[model samples]
Target: MISGPSENPELWAFLESLHRGEILCGTVTAIERFGVFVALDDGPDHPVFRGVGVITIPELSWQRIETAFDVVQVGQHVSAEFLQFDTWNLEARLSLRATQPDPFQAFADRTAAGQELHGRVTKLVPFGVFVQVTDGIEGLVHLRELTSTSVEKPSAVVQAGDEVTVVGTEIDRERRRLILSRRQGPTAH
Candidate 1:
């Protein structure tokens, strides 16, 4: 069902508040490949859509994930940033990532360079491997860091889902980049 402002007075007011960037808590009503539909608490219902809020894929989480379920599930309650009215669909476009605490910030606050931690390789890139060190936190292991021996590709030493120990070499808080090294006594699966 398409969404838009309803004739209900209270619903119109809710949409107005949402347009002002008001953060709201809502129960996820449905999960689709494209987005999550939310039944907002204290929010006006769409005349036909039944729910009033929608969070698109990119807005689901900070972490790169395979699907929306990786971050949230049906019936889960979530707090989201109300971006703006999706006039094309007449629904309030929301961002779930904006409301969650950043895991990278927490990981950096207590961690220092040269510390070791275990992580699972998440993605293999031409130049590096992306590893998930913790929930919502990932670091890049450059091709040079994957092995001491000269290698042309990162896949030579690492593949997705391999568990490896990594040493933190750099953490750029401003850019939110975490650099890791696997050369220091780290064994890969």
Candidate 2:
């Protein structure tokens, strides 16, 4: 059997003390394409690394970021939520965005179905175009919703960075999903 962090008594003990959702403060030691490494305060020294904590790209921020550097830099001190213990890597899995407000939740709080909003097309998929209705919120405009006329592909109707008007067809706060339509639809009363 492959040995794991549990074999290290000190590290195992330290990991036991950590609870999910607990906030942890640490200095970012390194930033890579895969994730960010942090030297957590009050944690035992890692046996092989400068830090004992890792924050994956998706945990770095709620907003869509091109890279981990977009959210944090090396040597920056940050507070992140404890996600879990990585047994294989012997690191604490952290979430920086958990310490920050969810922009999508905030957007959903103020937005309602049938609300018309202006946005820029951010991406085009085979099925639909994604429109950035706000800084961190993007809604899908399905192919049929691209326009009143039938379209074969999203690119045929919209391109990235194209300014467009869309109506909110659904704002699923629970799922954190928002559906939009280019064709004018009923307004929220």
Candidate 3:
């Protein structure tokens, strides 16, 4: 069934407290062949919604196919587990990797201009060249910042594993972004 913004009084109030990361119990109001639809009971006993979460396919009992009606039945209040709650979306996104370490958390540190990191050029975009510092971390060196020459394509000179040193230009702790540059290398003119 199309989950086009469900409508229910108890579900709305249940989602409010959930946006604040409050655990509110949600009663399975309606279950379709796709998945179970839960309505958080306004009562204090069923407090489950408190963070942003959802009940993805694997998290559910059976394989959650996009178009399957054989997974769940209607009006089956099956004490479903809670993962997270978001007020904007009026829903929660469940995940099995919730307890796992945040992948973006490692990007919190982007300061120290002199802190050199050996990276490889991944792409040669018109704007600049994309460098991969680590497996998941990447920094960009603007085209104008690579060299004062008429560098048209970044790949013209730089390629994969060129052993480029990343010099931090700007640090965004919140955005988890680091503006990097290769123009001011240690041995540059």
Q: What would you estimate as the lDDT of candidate 3?
A: 0.54
lDDT of 3 by residue, 1-189 (tens): 212235445555654444432344444454444344555354322234332234444545322246323444434433344566544555754432233343445554443655666788877788888787776667788877777576887777677667787776765666656677776757442
Residue-level error in angstroms, candidate 2, position 181: 0.6
List the pairs of residues colliding in candidate 1. none
TM-score versus the correct structure, for each prediction: 0.73, 0.92, 0.54
Question: Considering every candidate listed, which one attains the maximal TM-score?
Answer: 2
- Tell me the lDDT of candidate 1: 0.82
Q: Order the candidates by lDDT, highest first.
A: 2, 1, 3
**Residue 99 CA error for candidate 3 (Å)?**
6.0
**Native-referenced Cα lDDT, model 2:** 0.88
**True-structure Cα RMSD, model 3:** 9.4
The candidates, ranked best first by TM-score, are 2, 1, 3
- lDDT tens per residue, model 1, 143-172: 888887989998778789999899889998
lDDT of 2 by residue, 1-189 (tens): 223545677876787789999999999998888889999888987887778899999999988889998988889999999999887777899999999999999998899898899899999999999999999899999888888888898887778999988999999988889999878665311
Best by lDDT: 2
